[model samples]
Target: MSRTLINRLSHARRPLLALAIVAAALGTAHAGYNVWTGEYTFTKDELQSAVDKRFPATLRYGELVSVRLSNPRLVLDEAGNRITTRVDAALSNTVIPSPPVNGSLALNSGVRYDATRRAVLLDNPTVQDVEVQGMSQYREQLNAIGAVVAQQLLKDYPLYTFKPEELRFNGKDVEPGAITVAPDGIRVQVNLR
Candidate 1:
């Protein structure tokens, strides 16, 4: 009777062991999905390239006055959580044949994710600085013009966009929470909706 009982206990342990293994496997898979919050990173070159494509933009106040901005350079400000774009600028008066005032315009901007667009956009951009080669008298006016141009060009400008699948994970919809500027790149927080 003792040998028969021992054999029955061994048979019961085998099924229990198999059940435990299956339970652990399922738990591991669930944990893997739960552990993911979502972090999207983009390199400096990628941001720079996005900015470059919009450039050589001309803002005209009238037929006589126009400002052309081109050759943008993007700088990530990790500490400020902002970005800086410096573009070569040429302000010209169609009436004046003397020459175009050549200089560079610098803009500082924060970022936000637009759900409707599924893109990261430049938010609340301001004219950080302006340096013109020969136009010392018109610096103030130039700064104002730069602000308007920057607003039209950079405000809500998409820095990065997400595909339909990129925002969906494990059959769940996720959205961008916050944007962070890093030394190497930009980091976006993702959260479930």
Candidate 2:
């Protein structure tokens, strides 16, 4: 092989080697580390089992037709040991009612479930009219639907009461629209209307 050609081949090989190293590093960071830490030991079935045990009769993953989470609060207890968590969650979906309705319906509502207190203390609900074959249902049915939605939301995302227990918070009763849980911590997002 010509000297110039050999040199060019060597330069190309260096980049190829660098690219291979980078790819291996990324793979290790994404998946290899999980294997070493035993984080990947929990299979989807195992996770679903745990979640189902914690939240029975609640929709899991794709079963959730709609969901809205709002108003989160995180606070330290008087003892400053555990963290208190509170949030209002709203959810809705279609299900085969006992005496199944021939048509579909819409439900909506909000609820405050406190993990510390292990209680559902606050519920705010509203429902919209659902027409079946051009015939509108009673407002009471709509309200019932809303209540069901709220109850389901509570069931699905039960308040993390354990946080307060762990933090040693006083765990006082919470009110509606008072606080909420955020991605980072308890944060209230103000809306100017």
Candidate 3:
């Protein structure tokens, strides 16, 4: 009886040891570790600095022209997420402020920043009308203001690029206008016009 009991105990021990080994192997397989270096660290600041340098202070705004902008829209895609933006009302401006010339200069226009894509987007922007030589030269002044802003942005962010995807003038969709600006914000209309 003693011999038989001892043999049964040894057999149980072998299976228990095998189960422990299998559990350990699975744990290691599921562990979160860098496959190559087995380490992880944050690098957001370093990446942001490099992006800022590449894009610099120029090309913040575009050339100024006496034109009306109505129903602007923007579609952004990041990491498989799509974001749609639009403005409902139209805007007119004469003296758009220059883009940030340097880090010290405050941005005259509001811009939405997408950290994932490293992109900055400007919404409906406007500048007060200015008088030149006693004439209401709103168009020329607007164009000049736009030029200044664009130049500054270009300098600051050289890598920034824009492609026109759609144009919505007075609520009608225009092809090839990528970014749209609406002061009152976008609204959904259910009824067919």
Candidate 4:
């Protein structure tokens, strides 16, 4: 009777173990579908390329001829939830046919998502500093000008725009609630709709 009972218990244990394994596998698969959060990283080179494609190579303001941007650099701060960009601007004028005024500008900006527009927007960008060659006396003017230029450039150009494909999971569209930047990368928080 003891031998018979041991055989019966071993037979039951095999099926129970199999059932537990199947349940674990199913749980893992289910977890993938419920992953509402994901991070996408962008290097400075990638962002610079995107900006180059969307941003105008040159902007004009009356006498400001061929105001060109060069050597674009991007810095992300996740802790502060801010992004800082450094760029060199070459300002030329028709009146002063000499060398262009070489200026470096640093723009610090916060991130915001526009649900209605379905795009990422830079919020309240301020000019951290502007240094123009041999123009220390006009530092304030340069800073203001740089801020205005940065705002104008960012107005229509979004850092990232969500396509129907990107914001969708299992064919359902979701919203990107927040955009945060870190030293390493940018993170988009997804909100399931």
Best model number under TM-score: 1
- Tens-place lDDT per residue, model 3, 157-177, is 312222221112236432221
Choose the strongest candidate by lDDT. Answer: 1
lDDT values, one for every candidate? 0.85, 0.37, 0.33, 0.70
After superposing candidate 4 on the true structure, give the runs of residues whose Cα lies further than 4 Å from its correct spot: 1-45, 64-66
Regions of candidate 1 where Cα sits further than 4 Å from its true position: 1-37
Give the alpha carbon lDDT tens digit for every residue of 61-144 in model 1.
767778889999998999999999999988888887757888998999999999999999999999999999978898888888
lDDT of 1 at 74: 90
How do the candidates rank by TM-score, highest first?
A: 1, 4, 2, 3
lDDT of 3: 0.33
List clash counts for every candidate, in order.
0, 11, 36, 2
> Candidate 3's error at 110, in angstroms?
1.7
TM-score to native of every candidate shown: 0.79, 0.27, 0.19, 0.72
Per-residue C-alpha lDDT of model 4 across residues 118-167, encoded as one tens digit per residue: 87767777888888889899777677678787787654457766666666
Query: Superposing every Cα of model 2 onto the true structure, what RMSD results?
Result: 16.1
Indicate the worst ten consecutive residues by lDDT in candidate 4: 30-39
Q: 4-106, model 2: which lDDT tens digit per residue?
A: 9999999989988998887677445533112222221222233223323432233323552343434433332323222332333344454522332233333
| Candidate 2 wrong stretches, greater than 4 Å | 1-99, 102-105, 111-122, 128-134, 137-159, 168-178, 181-193
